[model samples]
Target: SQTIHQWPATLVQPVGSPLSLECTVEGTSNPNLYWYRQAAGRGLQLLFYSVGIGQISSEVPQNLSASRPQDRQFILSSKKLLLSDSGFYLCAWTGGAGAYGYTFGSGTRLTVV
Candidate 1:
């Protein structure tokens, strides 16, 4: 019974401000974690992934970064948020590539004003 948690459900921030989003998992270990961003009317885009602690892979080059400090803790951070950064952010996990579909947490919708 693995589960993921993310918050705050919605966010509004001015452009050029900093951003920090957190995700955590329970009931699983060594699971692959992923960070995805879905823009308005766009498909899910991978932002970062981690196979283990301190090992992260970046899929997109944007104004954001990701970190995995613990076994089930992943964080997304941005120094200066951009207008284009406003979107739905999702945190997901899976056993592996050939495993079952991903389990996504309750996403965070960010609006950069």
Candidate 2:
């Protein structure tokens, strides 16, 4: 069984704070990992994704960065946060595109104050 884990189910951070969110896949290897943000009632926006260790791709120009330090570990970080960064952050994984789709984490609700 494969599972994705994300932390701090909820967060309240001040503007300009540093942010770090981690996602890890257990029981899977070299899975495609993604970081997505969803505005209130809006569709998910792809922020970053990784296909392998040390490989990351950004889907949009933003204030966030993603890194894959290990085959099944992905990290999303920002040196400084923005008020617009508030949203629902979700970590997801898939063995392959158009396959089983995505297995998402419980998600983190971030509120920038």
Candidate 3:
């Protein structure tokens, strides 16, 4: 069975600070990884996606970035967080094409103060 894990369930940080969030998957290989951000009471917006190692695609140019260092490890980072950066960050995985649905990890809610 495939499972995903994300750390720091919630975070509070001052504006303009650095941000780093991690996600990892188990029981799967070469899965498509994605980072999505959901604003308060809004739908998710794709931030980045990785089809394979060192292969990242950015959906939006914002105060965020993503990287895939290992087959099952994905990371989201920001050099300087903005007030608008505060939201629910989610990491998801899909079994490439023909995948039915997404498997989302426990999300991290960030509050920029």
Candidate 4:
């Protein structure tokens, strides 16, 4: 019965504006969390991940950052968004057992102008 929640389904922001996207999980504890971005007709790109509260790992160096403030909460933020940052952002999680696939959020589509 685990579920992931992401907000502001779609957003359009001016270049250099700040951004904040949040994801949280329920019915689970200490799940492996991740953030991903998908561009037009492209595959998902791993952004950040966390294994535990206050522990985060970045897959690529970019203008964005992520944090795990709680065991089941992850946040992605940017101080100044770039046009290149526009994409579909998703939050996902694994049971850490590797027995099944990941559970993904509805995703946030960001457009920078």
Off by over 4 Å in 4: none
Give the per-residue lDDT digits (tens) of candidate 4, residues 27-71. Answer: 998899999999999999999989899999999999999999999
lDDT for position 62 in model 1: 88
Provide the lDDT at 61 for model 3: 80
Clash pairs (backbone) in predicted model 2: none
Measured on C-alpha atoms, candidate 1 has an lDDT of 0.95
lDDT of 3 by residue, 7-86 (tens): 88999999899999999999999999999999999999999999899889999888888889999999999999999999
RMSD of each: 0.8, 0.8, 0.8, 0.8
Q: What is candidate 1's CA lDDT for residue 103?
A: 94
Model 1 pairs in collision:
none
lDDT of each: 0.95, 0.92, 0.93, 0.95
Q: How close is candidate 2 to the true structure, as a TM-score?
A: 0.96
Task: Give Cα distance to truth, residue 1, candidate 4, Å.
Answer: 1.1
TM-score versus the correct structure, for each prediction = 0.97, 0.96, 0.97, 0.97
Cα lDDT for residue 73, candidate 2:
87
Q: What is the lDDT of candidate 4?
A: 0.95
Give candidate 1 misplaced runs (Cα > 4 Å): none
Model 4 alpha-carbon miss at residue 2, Å: 0.8
